[model samples]
Target: MHICFICDEYPPAPHGGSGSSYRDLSEGLVAQGHQVTVVGVYKNPQWHGGKGVDETINGVRVVRLPSSPSWLRYKLQTLSDRLKISRWLKCEHQKNPFDIIEASDYGGWLRFGGPAGVPTIVRIRGSNYFFDVELKRNGDPFEHKIEEAALARADFIGSVSRYASERTLDICKLSHRSCTVIHNAVDMDLFSPSPGVSRERGLIVFVNSINPKKGIEQLIDAMNVVCAKFPEAKLAVIGQDTQKPVDGITYVEKLKQRMKPEFLDRVIFTGRMDRYKGVLDYLRRAHICCYPSHMETFGIAAIEAMSIGKPTIFSETGPGPEVIEHGVSGLLCNPHDALDLADKIVAILSSDELAERLGTNARCRVETLFNKKHWVQRNVEFYERCISSNSHENGRCGCK
Candidate 1:
């Protein structure tokens, strides 16, 4: 079966969950002996040789279209480009007809898929309702429109979590049967925890982009409290500022300023990494993993840390609560509570026996939940079903 992926995000230029999520799916599909082509937007084209057409990289065929000025300059424009992507794919259909088209997000699939006569599935990353909750009101109408269309028009829909799946219906006013929930998979080999892997007295690793929604500020505040007790504690941050620095809104800088002076000095920023090498290296070097994000649809970083036998502390929201079985895998604190996070960080760092036990279980959990070979087979079977369904639909000549 041939699968065409219309993904809004991909690696080197990060767009959070969608980029990493599509990468994992692409690799898994290839291993399962399926032909897959990805269409994504690249922030900079010069790095990819020539951008507007097909280029194979990392064993996956990718076509990156030049993102329009609107897509590049403003958030609203990016969400509004489903028609643009639809037109691009429609033109490409002449060169080679796609058997199954999968849109990893709402914007394009919502606008593009039905027109193509292809059975389209838009994998919901999460619902924009969270964005509404964050803003204390509804999100942008343009963003809302795409998600609504995707939910209404998609031949089938899948979401990252049950929470996200249900929320999709609520936001779009669709039925319960409208979407299926498919959890993301992890590469257990890369993320398994190492036993007795102790670093210097207090090394805390905080990965993910340095943004407010990620709850980095709360993590920093919690670390401040924990650091006072263990003065040697250091929090190593392994992501960069995702947005262009606005005049008065420097989130990362603000975090540093608010943190205790001594604790802030211990916080090392490694910027955004192009690949997993830098992240893997830092994870191995750290004594513990601290993730305080509230809006994570799935906490892959924390899951990866667990696979590596490292005990992780994360929030009680979304994937965090789903993955960390509290005291079983690691500890779960309130999403943005500084006091709660501080207590957990200190407790994990102080206890060698507990950390060792949690690390072992964490690694085991990754094997059970995210085994690569297991997922590869599942994806292959799913692709076959999608193709079969498409063939069946096309051949139907009931009432003319």
Candidate 2:
């Protein structure tokens, strides 16, 4: 089967869950004897080679389209971007028609309805509408219209978690649309526990963008409480701040200001590390990983930590409860409650036996359910189903 992905983020261009997961899926599908092509947009074309560049990375063919700075002319820029992406996909389709075209829902790709008769599947990765609702922002009316149109036109839709799917429906009022929930998978071999990296005692790691939606402020507050009990406890923050500076202060600086001087010294910020190398290394070295996000599609960071056999704590909301058994595989805490998070942190820190048990259980759970191989297989089945359904509806196989 031939699969083509349209997304704005891909490795070496920008880092995010959608890009990383799509990369993993593409490579895994290729390994399984399926042909894959990816068409992605780069925010800064100059950072990467000038503009349109087609290359194969890790056996998957990738085409990178340069996007004009959207901030300068938001509406015009995105409209131009959509047209360019559509044209590229149509040209590629002429060469070797795709069996299925899967696009990330982030950039409103579904609005164009994809290449002619191709079965376009929009995989939900939290759209602007979902983000605005989560952050309590009054989003642009135009953006909401674009997202709703895309959702309506998409032949099929899939999301990393049921929570995300439900949220998208609630926001778009697409109660008639059927959304498939497929959890993100991790590369176990790459994230497996390493004896080479020495684990730091009483160390906690939080990996996500430095923003309020990620609940970083709440994590800091919880850390203050944790430090009151264990002075030596440390929190290492990883990931970039995509938000603009608040009140002339950077998000990182704001977090530092909120922390007590003594507790501040115990925290380390490694702002946006290389996902494969720096991120895995940090997870391997940490004693515990915490993802107290106020909103999440699937909590890929938490799953990556779990893959490394590190006991993780996630917010009780969203997909956390669904992914973890709470006290069996991992621990869960209320996203808005610092006291609850602090207590969970202390419990894991004080009991080495409990930590080990949770970590071991987490590793087992990932291996059985969240491994890359299983993810690719499920996607293959989904693609086949979509293709068969579309063909039946059209009275012929559309693929050339």
Q: Highest lDDT: which candidate?
A: 2
Please give, for residues 149-265, the per-residue lDDT of candidate 1 as tens digits.
656666667777676666556657775555656667778766554455445558888888887777888987887788889877888888888756678776677778878775678
After superposing candidate 2, which stretches have Cα over 4 Å from the reference? 68-72, 395-400
Q: What TM-score, over all chains together, does every model reach?
A: 0.89, 0.94
Model 2 residue 3 CA deviation in Å: 0.9
Q: Scored by CA lDDT, what does every candidate get?
A: 0.71, 0.85
Worst 10 residues of 1 by lDDT: 391-400
What is the clash count for each candidate, in the order shown? Answer: 8, 0
Q: Which pairs clash in the backbone of model 1?
A: 191-307, 191-308, 192-307, 192-308, 192-309, 193-307, 193-308, 193-309
Question: Candidate 1: RMSD over Cα atoms?
Answer: 3.4
TM-score of 1: 0.89
lDDT of 2 at 261: 89
